[model samples]
Target: MALYNKRINDQLMTNCLALSNELLEKETHSFFPNIMSYWNHILFGDLILLRRLALNHIAGLTPQTLSALPTPKSPQDIYCRKLSDFAHLRSQVDELIIQYCTNLTDENCEQFISYTTTEGESITKVIADLTQHIFNHQAHHRGQLTCVLSQFGVNYGCMDLPIIVSEGSRANA
Candidate 1:
C-alpha cells in the first residue's frame, strides 16, 4: 500500500535520526577516531543529498557521471553539523511527503520527477526508483557505520528496519 510504504519511509527516516544520535553518543567512547569520522561523513553526505532532493532537484546526479565526495577529516565537528542539517532536511522531507502523499495516485508513484543534481549533471528517474535509492543509500552507509561501531565493540542494537518497525509500532506507528 502507498500509505504503508510512506509510513515505512517515515519510520526509516526516524530510525536514521535515532541511529545517528545513538552513534554520536557511542562515538564519544570510540577507540577509532578515523572510523568515527568516516561514519559521520556517510550520514552527513546522505543528509546533504536528501536536502538536495528536497529542493525538487534531480534527486541525485553528479556533475560528472561519477561524483567523488571528499574525504572526512574530523568526526565531532562533522557529526554535529550534519545533525543540524539532517534535522532541518528531515523536517522538510516529512512535510513534503505528507503534503503530496495524498495526491500521489497510482500513476504518480511511477511518475518521474526530473531535475538536475547540484553537480550540474542531469538525471531523470521514477519516484519509486529514487525513493528506493534513498533508503538503500542510507542502509549502505549505516552498514559501514555498524562495522565501525562493531570494531570498537559498540553494538548497534536495533539498527535494522524490521527492528525499527516493530519498535515504531509501539511508539509512533
Candidate 2:
C-alpha cells in the first residue's frame, strides 16, 4: 500500500508540474471546478486523516507533525492559485503519508480511530479502514480530474498500479 501510494503521488506531482498554469486553473463542470481544486482537496483529505491518526498518540505509530495542519473549511479554502505551490505542497504531504504508512504496524492498523466529521458528526473506525478510505477518496477525485483533463485534451497518462509495479520490476531486472 505504501509503495502504491508513493508511486501514484509521484505521478500526480509530475503531471501537475507538466501542466500549464492556465490548464491547471481551467474551470470545469465537475463537482470540483478545476484541476487545482481536486489537487487541493486530495491534500486536505490526507492531512485530516493524518491528524486523526496522530490522535492515537502511540509512540512511533503516529504522524507527529499533523497537529499543526490547518483544517480546511472547504475544498475551495485549500486551493492554491499557483501550480508550483500546489505541487510542492502535494509532494511534501505525500512524503508524510508514505512515512506514516511505512511506519504503521499490524497492531496499530487494527486500532480504532475516533473523530468528529467536519459536519460535527462523531464516527469511529479501524485505522486500516480509514487509511484505505483516504486512498480511495483520492482516486475518486483523481478520476474526476482526468475527466476534466480529457475535456481539455490533456492526457495525464497511465495511473494503473499494476503497470507501475511491472515497470518497476522490469527496471530492477
Please tell me which predicted candidate would have the highest TM-score against the true structure: 2
| Candidate 2 segments whose C-alpha is farther than 4 A from its true place | 58-63, 67-69, 166-173
Top candidate, metric lDDT: 2
Using Cα atoms with residue i matched to residue i, what is each candidate's TM-score against the true structure? 0.48, 0.85
Candidate 1, residue 98: lDDT: 42
Writing each residue's lDDT as its tens digit, candidate 1 over 16-40 gives 4555555554553333354435445
Candidate 1 lDDT score relative to the true structure: 0.47
- Per-residue lDDT for 1-173 in model 2, tens only? 55676677777667678888887777797888778888888877877777777778532534547544565565456647787877766777777777777777888888887888888989989988988887898888878877787788776678788776563465555
- Candidate 1 regions off by >4 Å? 1-105, 167-173
